[model samples]
Target: MNEINNILYITGAGVSEESGIPTFRGKDGFWKIGSKNYTPQEMATRRMYKENPEQFLSWYYKRFAAYRNHGPNKVHHWLANKNLITQNIDGLDGKAGNQNYIAIHGRLDQMTLFHTQGDNVATQQAPWDSVDETSLTESLLEVFKISLSTRKPMKSQSFKPYVLLFDEYYTELYRISEAQQRMIDADKIIFMGTSFSVNITQMALEIAVTQNKPIEVVDPYPVRIPYENTTYHRMKASEYIERAD
Candidate 1:
């Protein structure tokens, strides 16, 4: 294989699975373990946050908070120096010292004001440490700036998780424009550990197809794309890195 230049690596949950983070789509994944009254699809949405804040916060805290400290694996370390756009909210790529990568799906360790996208709001570090699961509801309410007495989010005071909810669209908050520009400028696009289910992957693939750029998919069971210059690496992300090295 020739040395590929201007390569943009678009990663997904599969990349973080090696670091003991759940892909959230497997049979035992987080999405499969929804709350008593809601499915994961329903629970992970803006509607849920607005209508049932307690359940939403509780579910998010239980599932995503536990993996907040997972260290990056070899794949993350290898991709650290490369042009990258990861779909993971785990924030492991940043942990691996990749300062320039885009986390298109937002991040678990961050929070923003409860405002719509493209609203030019600022984000801050989430106060996960202040939460106690024993008093999960109240703790989340306090940390997220919700009112305990009314069980409603305080206007302008309440905050939302940095994650891109199910019903939310990509916006400047997630750096969607920069990511799209990266896709357009790349000479080659490599998708690692992704199932090609999300919009970002599809967007990248479309760009690659239209621009006639080489495409690579790395996974244990790679999804085949019908492009002329596409390649498939049927292996784990770490395995692919080792082979490349």
Candidate 2:
């Protein structure tokens, strides 16, 4: 347990399945991929957000079923109880009892959208219809939280996916924070469940290795990808949870 303090955890979809979200990439025999399934980049992009906001929101909200069907599980619960950085935004980390953490890609429970640079928004929810204000970044923290806590679509505020989409630059990218930088610069990085599909996030891993840090890659399959200095573990996420106290 003491070793975890030196840890930087980068979790992906696999870590979330225990909470009931389906990842079409992993082979648990649950979700089958089809030609119709939109490439994550296509479905979750700024262009889509503008061209078809409702469709984008629908795909995202339905996938983020944890908002309604499930809660945090042993792994997320365990991470919250610890002091490690994570890459998930399923809100399980919060439910797991951890309040302070960095979401490298973004979060599903928060909302961010394109508004005129200086315009103010009130909340981040799905099927967001509000036009004058449509981003979570523009609102106060208290007001934003209230916007997500309810189910009704408001006449004044809109709620969009809190998760950063394919082509959208993060609000943090313009000015990187210290804690986020530290998490990226850890002595040991542990990756769980995510297939390294996106180039931007993959860049972070590249940065970590370039700095001479060692990485431990954990997944159900041991298939190797590029980049040296990574240790691999072939095991299901649930397998570890089964043994945890």
Candidate 3:
């Protein structure tokens, strides 16, 4: 019998591309297609949320909420039973039934108290559960406790999307410590569909390099990492999973 290695799968937007979601850096990726008035970097920040709550929430709702009904794809199902830390916030991993996977970037389908990072606050299902697409904007404003007239977040009643913004650092809210420990403990680390643009990927790569763990990258056009033990598989995530099966 082949010994099962404790492999850790770290995924990114590419994993969900097959599920009809765009990658953050792809030609049609979310970050690449920011709002008309602002760049994604500007729109997806804590500053935007605080200063221009309406525009921030409107942009978020239009881009992210549209994919709320998308189901998990083959890659998500394949990684469902494996140890995984995903940077995608689509919640497809959870939809695929991966009960314990860590969403290092946070989830779009959830919400938390509108507090700063490191605050130990509980999360709940996003208000989208109760509102349809047409009413999402008003519902969002209501749930986040933003005053409809003043367009400012109300204290204590405000909730934010459970996503990590560009201006924010990793904290307990996103399970950063747990993800680091998993990177250390895994015998092998598999990076799927990520462009190596995010800090989480860099953090995992550093851990893998320091521990001398084997690294495998799966992407149609994989980025070249300056690591000795890293292997690159130039294939789409679904194709890679099919070959593995």
The candidate that wins on TM-score is 1
Sorting all predicted structures by TM-score, with the top scorer first, yields: 1, 3, 2
Looking at candidate 2, the ten consecutive residues that score lowest on lDDT are 137-146
Q: What ranking emerges by lDDT with the best candidate at the front?
A: 1, 3, 2
Per-residue error for 13 in candidate 3, Å, reads 0.6
Let me know the TM-score candidate 2 reaches against the reference structure. Answer: 0.69
lDDT over C-alpha atoms for residue 87 of model 3: 94
lDDT values for all models: 0.91, 0.57, 0.89
Residues 140-174, candidate 1, lDDT per residue (tens digit)?
Answer: 99889888887777546799999998999999999
- In model 2, the runs with Cα more than 4 Å from the true position are 1-4, 27-40, 65-67, 83-85, 112-159, 173-180, 223-228, 241-245
Relative to the unseen true structure, what is the C-alpha lDDT of residue 96 in candidate 1, on a scale of 0 to 100? Answer: 98
How many clashing pairs does model 2 include?
Answer: 3
Best by lDDT: 1
lDDT for model 3, please: 0.89
At residue 210, give the lDDT of candidate 3.
92
